[model samples]
Target: MTRFLHDQFAKDYLEELLTPYGTIQSSRPVSSEVREVDLWFSPHPESTLSPDSLGLLARAIQTPAIFEPFRNPATTREIRDCLLKLLEIDAELRRESNRQVSLAPDTSPPHLWILTPTASRTLLGGFGATLDLESWPRGVYFLPPQLRTIIVAIHQLPRTPETLWLRVLGRGRVQTQAIEELEALSPDNPWRANALILLNRLKAHLERNLNPDWEDRQLIMRLSPLFDQQLEAAQLSGLQQGLQQGLQQGLQQGLQQGLQQGLQQGETLVIENLLRFRFGEVDEELAQIIQAILRLPASEFTPLLMQLSREELIERFREE
Candidate 1:
């Protein structure tokens, strides 16, 4: 169960960072075997965000790519499965460019990225992976250019701000240390906001049990102060804005509007996080439904959004 949650968090973390820079297709299916890639990213010519923001992590991805992140060390078999998915994509891209091949050469197919907490020397040797220590940071092993794959050993990565984001995907002490660094980041940082939101959701999930694991309990304790800080800051900002607007719009009406707006924003956050937890990522139609639900009081929308399955939520929200 912990592994499952970690896998989901890795996907969500990658999506949050990469989606603004290009296209992100999560759980993408390939071949006739029905195998799914965790994340398929294709960079855009006109990206809004620079790849450099991702630090050493971004250096590994400069082309169409497939991301397969594991909660623990990935086995040789799992690595092969990731490669097979890339080959299937290669075949499909070739099929599409059959006519174009006569006029111009085709661009290379997507590369596969195996993200794991650790990769043993034997494991790296088995696949003939090489480390480019000078250009790239430590812990990154690349296969021959033809194979177009890289293995990221998260535990081996440097302990710095540049690598902190990737280290959060690691295990045990590494992850705990990364979380501490994450909180130290400026609250206005977008990654900081996204990470905290996911951590809160993770905390909620673990708390459902009467007694969560010791690690989870410790993590929740670490996250609580950050959560309180954000809440307090948001409330203060809302009050200041409300005071200014109240003078012009009449005190009672302006305060009411400000309070409602604040609550609705909270509702939207909860709804989106719950949807992502259950459905991976929300799509356009679902986003619309979430907006509509936000119009309702929190009591009415909260239970419906949290309790329903994807289909059920869509059906119920769409009908209303």
Candidate 2:
């Protein structure tokens, strides 16, 4: 489940990164016969379409398709076919003359980018091997230089707490370089906030694991707000269930013991009553002793009852 969320996050991150450069379209249908492209990006000005434009297109297309139980195979095939068609379209567009002058024909072909989280070994083999990186029908080329940079950037993105902290601590050595590059392209960037948040989360994890003495009473906070709440509620529910089970078992055991004691006492009272009826009266002291004997094992209590005279028996049978 968490993996699914992470994959979605990656897709969204890629989308956000590309949104600034062009008109971003997602699940866009290329033709009536084909499925929609996962994402399609086009330059606003037709004249601006160049290697850089193709590079941006490549980046947009490289985002992985998330598959689930209900994923449609036909839709997947349609999307693939649509992308192939779009690549051809991009090639034709690039070849057209901007002005009346017929310039030398741009002979480069467009590249098709496919992204998936877990590509099969076979698919990866096809990526750099059988899947031609150079020539295609469209003027767009695969493995554009700018798109390669973006791929490197994606690889360098912090995916875990440890990596986040490492990037922060090595800010001078590592992130500074990337920051400078990004700033050169877009001076006022919003990605800084996201980068900082990732750093903070990494710091928090470090504080919890490494600095036992540094207690910020509020610092033992939940990593995920929703999951943490649910975890706490689940623990409390389990504890309640355990306590109830223990109490029920205790009550059942106590009731069984109590019933046994009551039955023994009742039998002793019957014996005492019989002696009182036969011998006229029972002594108070003897009756108290006989009552105490009710708690003895039935074998012991029965043997003690046989060795008494009528008057002795009457005295032994007396009630308190």
Candidate 3:
């Protein structure tokens, strides 16, 4: 229904990172035109710290704000549209407080943060956006003070862990590099797990829809190894734990679960990843083929999945 999986991923990623420090509402209605803001965040009154993983991204926002993330470079029309939504929101807030816009506190109305992968110099100059290079970074461009808006060009941001949280929302190599850093983080980090799950889903979507974009293809390739590595790591942990507990207890029960099903599930996960990696999400038609794969010996079907075409896979497993 949405244009692509990346749109949803961007919103989910921002919501998760901001959830710890604020109240966030995604796809919130704003104007009479029925425009929906991507994210509306109101910071908590007592909170001072956001998740350390977010780094500089957290430091950028210290007040209530609206965050609109674009998977593509935002155009002038899109910028004006975003401004209109911001105006409507500001009006609504002023009405709710029953206060004059001029009389209320400077931040009574939330600021609009438009985050695009890139913004051209022409667009920035046309809108009269100035970079606060002293306080903020290079990619951040501010409108005149009263307009209350900023454009964040992720690609133009500095390459550092401080910007990695924002960079993960970028395209192609930027996102891949950020994901690599995320993978290097402790496996116990919940943010990494959430991001990886979304990335896996993103890969599946790209695979299923027959994405012609080179960028999507590159992303899928980059994510494939991450999925494989994590699967192997999880399988090893399962095996080691099972063997240790089995040695202390009845060997039969331990072997039955840890050794047998652990390997099966681990292999199954890989097979599932490979299937999705190869063919996309399992449709009702494809699900039957996967069930058949589950029934077969792991070695037999695992190799087959790697080698079979979609049509060949359907013909091979449809009857089973």
Candidate 4:
């Protein structure tokens, strides 16, 4: 996959998975120069979802963090660049701490996670990155503590539940296997549907590429069956709920009005589900505009939900 496409996918995927437990700032700008952190996350003091659901990724984000994911192996220059960002953030945090006497004594800089599919021995050696197997898993290499950086070599990670989330960003066989595990997860698993939906979105983006490479073609093929399965399941579930709801309404109101209302309610549920998946929460503003968006045909509204920003969606649907 191309870097641009993969970068967007990584950001969105992590954001979707982590949003409930913390604050997420994708493409967060830093300093006067135009530098952007791919993803910055700070965990909520208390969250509904268990950290165990995300496994190792949860551990990585226990504190404030900066995540920079690479579709391919990271180069030495890229590694250094990530460290520079880390140092910059450290300085910024220290400055703020100095400015505010009330700041906690334990306040510290965010950890930097450089996520790459693979890191060659030579590359790791140059950075003096060493494994801390006692404290972390195999695949996680830490640069000296002063640097406060960790390079997660996705391919090197053990194939287990703990590694599944990060492995979803791996390439070739690794990613394919992760997808299989993700597909096998329980339907009730909170992250399962969201992960699948983001993967489906990634598949759609790959399809739009005019001349896809071999790996991109392979990824698209892998996602096809899963996409069809999710679509069918979602449709069936919606239809069933709508039918039951319509029947209940018919008993109370006129049969025609009840059935129509039931269908509308089902469609509304589907739209709300999509919104929640995309934006993490359906706040008052978003809840108010659901009916407005529902007025459009599926072809139009589906893309609107998938592609538009929150502001764009509100601007287009709120007035009507």
Q: Rate the local accuracy (lDDT) of all candidates.
A: 0.74, 0.37, 0.75, 0.84
Question: In model 4, which runs have C-alpha deviations exceeding 4 angstroms?
Answer: 46-51, 102-107, 251-320
On a 0 to 1 TM-score scale, where does candidate 3 land against the true structure?
Answer: 0.74
> TM-score rank, highest first?
4, 1, 3, 2
lDDT of 3: 0.75
Candidate 1, residues 1-320, lDDT tens digits: the string is 76676688789788877776678899988877989999988877565454457776575456777889998799999998888888888887777779564422224577888989999999999999999988878898999888889999999999987788789888778988998898888766767776766666565556565756777678777767765665455444544554444444544566677566555454566666656644568888788797677667755665455435567778877876
- Supply the TM-score for candidate 1: 0.75
Better of 1 and 2 by TM-score: 1
Candidate 2 residue pairs in backbone clash: 35-78, 64-115, 91-138, 91-139, 108-139, 109-138, 109-140, 110-140, 287-318
Residue pairs clashing, model 3: none
Residues 281-318 of candidate 2 have per-residue lDDT tens digits of 56774566665555566445443343233455445545
Q: Model 2's lDDT to the true fold?
A: 0.37
Q: Give the clashing residue pairs of candidate 1, or none.
A: none
Among the numbered candidates, top TM-score falls to 4
Q: Candidate 1: where are CA atoms >4 Å away?
A: 48-52, 99-108, 209-212, 247-320
RMSD each, Å:
5.6, 29.9, 7.6, 3.3
Q: Candidate 1: deviation at residue 183, Å?
A: 1.5
